[model samples]
Target: MADGILRRQIQLAAANLSEAIDGADGFQNTHQSQHCESAKFSIEQVVFILEKIHIMWESVLPRSIYRRSMFHVLGPVFSRITKDMLLIDDMAAEETLQLQGLIHLALENLSSLFLSLVENDDDEKFLDHHTWVQLDESIPSLKKFRKLAELLDMSLKSITAAWESGELANCGFTSSEMRNFIKAIFADSPLRKECLGWIVATPA
Candidate 1:
C-alpha cells in the first residue's frame, strides 16, 4: 500500500538522519564542516520525507480527520522543519546550537502526539476502526522520531561540553563566552519561546 511505503520511507529517513548526527559527533573543527554537510544532507532528506508524509496524510485521511486540531498542529511543525533545513547552511555554530534545540523540541512534540494516538482508543469511535488501524501503522516511525530527539539533545550537550573544556578552541569562542553569547541571542529571539512551547505543550 502507498501508506505503508510512505511510513517505511519516513522511518528510513529518520534512521539516516540519526546516523548522520552520530557521525557528526566524532569530528573536530578541522573536519566539522564535512560532518555538517553530511548532517545537512540527512536533514534535507528528512524534510523531503516529512513533506511527502504530510501530503499523504492529507490525501488518505478523511477531510474531517485531516482538519482535526491534532492533525493541524503538525502543519506548523513540519513547516518549521523545512524552514530550518533551508537556513542550516547560513547559521553560525551558536545559531546552529539553538536550531538543534528547536529541532529536538519539535520532534519531541511530534513523538508525543503520535504516542498519544497509538495509546488512546477514543479516536476509534469517531474515526472508523480501519482508519485508526491505518494511523497505527505509523507508530514505529513516531518512536524513531523520539529516539532522534534524544540523540540531537545528546549531541548538543556533547558539543557544549567540548567547548567548556577548551577542546573547541579552534572553532573560536571559549566555553564561558559561548554560553553567554547563546543566552543573549536566545533571550532576544522569539524562537526561544516557540521552542519552549513545543517542549512543554500537551499533545492535542
Candidate 2:
C-alpha cells in the first residue's frame, strides 16, 4: 500500500509537470506574456519542475524512493521536451543554444543530486552508493534526451554521420524522431531530403 501511494504521488507529479510544460498551469500565462515565445516558456517551466523535484529529494522523500520516483516522473518529460520544444519549427540558433545550456545544466544538477553527490561551491563530492548508478543506467530516455540536446546544435553532416554510425539509433531514437528532428532543424535542401530518405529506409 505504501509503495502504491508513493507511485501515485509520483504519477501526479509527472502529470503536473506535463501540465506545466503544456502551459495548462498558471506559470505559463504570466511568463509567456512577457517573453512571447512558447518554446522558451516551456523550457523555463521544465526548470521550475526540476527545482520542485530537487526540494522533494532533499526533504520530503526517502533516499530509497528516489530512483523509482525520478524515473517515473522524468521519463515522459524527456519525450515531451523533445516533441514540443526541441522539435519546434524555425527556432532561432541563438535561442536554441541558450535553451540547450539551460536544460543541460538543469539535467546535470538533477543527475548529481540523484547520485547522492554533495554539491558545494567548489565541486561535487561523491557518495558511496550504487543505487543511484542503477537508476541512471536503467533509464535509457535520459541518455537519449541529453544526446538530443547535442544533436539540436550539430551540423547536418555531423548529424547524418551520427545517424549512419548507429549512434542515434543506439541512443534509443526512432526513425520517426529523426525525421521530425531533421524537418524541424534543417531547411529543405537536397541534403535534408537525403537524410530524411535515409531515416525512412532504416528499420526500427
Candidate 3:
C-alpha cells in the first residue's frame, strides 16, 4: 500500500515535470512576460515534487534500510533541483527552458532507480557494489550540474552587486528582484544543506 502510494506520487510528479518541459518548449521565443510566467508555473511543479520526495524520504521509506542508498542516488538530484528552482525566477527564458529539460532528465533517472529498488526485494542488494556503481554513474552529471549552478549563482551575485553600486547604469542593467531572490535562495533552502550532509556521509 505504501509502495503504491509512493509510486503514484512519483508518477504524478514526473508527469507534471514532463508537461512543464513541453509547455516551456512551446513558449520558447514568445514574449518575455509570457515565457516567465510559464517558467514560474513549471518551477512550482518541480518544487511540489521536491516536497513530495522529501516526505517519501522521511516517512514512506524505512530509514534504517533505505536511507544510505536512497539518499546516495537522490541527494545530489535534490540539491540540483533546489538550486535550479531558486535561480529559475531570475533566469532568462531560454535558460529556464534548458533547466526544465535537465530537471526532466533527473526525474527519469530517479524513476528508473526507484523501479529497480522495487523489483529487487532483497534489502541486501540495495547496498551492494552494483547499486553503488549505478549511483556512482549518476554523480558525474550531478556534479557538473552543481558546478554550473554555483557559477550561475556567483554571476548573479556579481551582477546584482554591480547594479546596486550604479556601475551598470550606463548599460541599463537593473535588478530590483535579484537581491531578494538570492537571499531567499540561500535562506529558505534547507534541502540544499540536507543534501550536502548526505553527500558528506557517503563513503569515499
Candidate 4:
C-alpha cells in the first residue's frame, strides 16, 4: 500500500510538472532561463528515487541465481524503469535547455555511489555475500550511471565525454565538493585523483 501510494504520488507530481513545464518559456524555446530552478526540484526528486533504487538493488536480490546463472535477473528490469523516467526528465530539460543543473546532480550521486562500490570492491567476496545481486559494478555492471548520463550527454556532450575519458579537468565535479567526496569515499587511490580531476574540470 505504501509503495502504491508513493508511486501514485510520484506519477501525479510528474504529471503536474510536465504540464507546468510545457507552459514554461525560454528554458523551453529560448535562451531565457525561467522555470529551470523549479525544474531542478522535480528532476532532483526523481533522480534521488532512482539512485536509491539502484543502491537497494545491491542490498537486495537473491544470490543463488546470481552465482548459478551469472546474470542480473532483477537489475535490468528496474534499470529500464529508472532509465525511462530519467528520459522524461531529459526530454524536459532539452525542451528547456536546462542541462547539468539538477539532473547533473543526480548523475553525480549515482556516479559517486558506483565509485564508492568500485573503490571498496572486494574481488574475493564479489557476489558471495548475496547482498548485491543486481548492482552495476560487479561482473557486468553498467559502469556507474546510464540514462542520466545519456541525457546529460544529449544536453551536455563534451563534459560527459571528458568524464569518461578520465580527464581531471572534465571530471564533472566541483573542487571542494570533489575533494570532500573523494576524501571521504576514495581516501587514497588513482581513481580518487581521476574523479576529482574530472569534477573540477567538468563545466557547469
Q: Write one digit per residue (lDDT tens) for candidate 2, span 1-204.
A: 277887777777787778767762221222233543554556567667766776766476665466556666777877676555444545555555655664575576565545542223435455334543444366667667778778868988787778878888888887877777778667799999987887677655
Give the lDDT of residue 132 in candidate 4.
36
Instruction: Summarize candidate 3's per-residue lDDT along 1-204 as a digit string, tens digits.
Output: 266775665566556556654555433432366765675565555555655565566565675434443444355445445444544444454554455454554444455344344335664544455554454354444433433333333444454444445543322222433343344334445653443343334322
Which lDDT values do the candidates have, in the order given?
A: 0.42, 0.64, 0.46, 0.40
- By TM-score, the better pick of 2 and 3 is 2
TM-score of each: 0.29, 0.72, 0.36, 0.31
Candidate 3 segments whose C-alpha is farther than 4 A from its true place: 1-5, 26-31, 64-140, 150-204
Could you report the Cα RMSD, in angstroms, for every candidate shown? 14.7, 5.3, 15.7, 14.2
Backbone Cα, N, C clashes tallied per candidate: 0, 0, 0, 11
TM-score of 1: 0.29
Candidate 2 whole-model C-alpha lDDT, 0 to 1: 0.64
Score candidate 4 by TM-score against the native. Answer: 0.31
Put the candidates in TM-score order, highest first.
2, 3, 4, 1
lDDT tens digits by residue: candidate 1, 130-198 = 544544344323323333233334443453444445444432323343334334334445654443343
Q: Name the lDDT value of residue 122 in candidate 1.
A: 64
